[model samples]
Target: MSRIVIILACSLLLVACKSPEARRPISSKSGSFIDASVARNIKLNEKEQAYIKKIMSENPEEEYIASENGFYYFYNIKQADSLISPDFGDIVNFNYNIKTLNDDVIYTKEDIKTQNYVMDKQELFSGLREGLKLMKTGETVTFMFPSQKAFGYYGDENRIGLNVPLKCEVSINSIIDN
Candidate 1:
């Protein structure tokens, strides 16, 4: 009898703990919310593109490569064996400095210790991860990314702000195969 009572209590608790999406209020204006979100994202993308183009034009001497994923990068130093790069699941160690396109430094390697992450596994900024994948050990490069690629609408909520595009100077110190 006690087992039956415990089982009923557990079932009730499970039913009460439904996911937020399952418990969300269904509103007649739900479609409008989605439409507004899409429109806002489109505008932000346009702003980021314009900022990148302006920066590129300002630095006429530096050659920049545009990626299909909507970012740009230029390497200051390239590794001799360009064919070798970090693969997914590999551990990569690097130092980086992050800044706004307006040249305001947000963070740098000096502010923290050398960083390490599993390539394509950790939730490091998407743009930084993509840029790292393009580099081999001992290569250093600067990558510029749109707000969407960097921090999206909310930004980092600390050093970075909302809808801000970013640039990162990355040095790939090493890549350890797992």
Candidate 2:
């Protein structure tokens, strides 16, 4: 009787673990979110030029850093982990503002109380998601995300137009295990 009861319990547990939707794969239409023309005409402003120059000069190794799939470059990382084994899955809480290298404000959530956002490895763009994953909590890095990794080479027409260059200021606040 005890053996039969144990078998029944195991069977019930197995059945409970199955979800009808688990076997199906998520599908998305092609070109549903792909744009490649946004980074086409990027013009850097005086202030942006100054900052880029300063950072580039301060960190000569920056030029050596390879780019990801998009225009984003990981350079002069203040407190990044080693390249051999970088942390790419950590959850980073940060406050970011999107703008054009020309200092044109594109997106800002300054009114929010926390002014911070959480980024997951798979949830963000290829460049941004990969870039932030390389940093530790409390790490601050400035990266220029070309349209390819951003809204794609073609930008969101309602927000930024096609082929426009964009920049994002990122500051990692904390790391959370999601």
lDDT of each: 0.88, 0.58
Clashes of each: 0, 15
Q: Any idea what lDDT model 1 has?
A: 0.88
Candidate 2 similarity to native, TM-score: 0.50
How many clashes would you count in candidate 1?
0
After superposing candidate 2 on the true structure, give the runs of residues whose Cα lies further than 4 Å from its correct spot: 1-64, 70-77, 80-90, 109-122
Top model by lDDT, which number? 1
User: 1-178, model 1: which lDDT tens digit per residue?
Assistant: 9999999999999999976665666655558888998998998798879889999999998899998778999988888875679999999999998888887989877985699989988898788888888899999999999988898878888878887888888998988988
Candidate 2 RMSD computed on C-alpha atoms after optimal superposition onto the true structure:
15.1
Q: Model 2: per-residue lDDT, tens digit, 124-175?
A: 5565676666566556566776555577545776787764556776666666
Measured by TM-score, the strongest candidate is 1
Candidate 2: residue 62 lDDT (0-100) = 55
Model 2, position 31: C-alpha lDDT score: 56
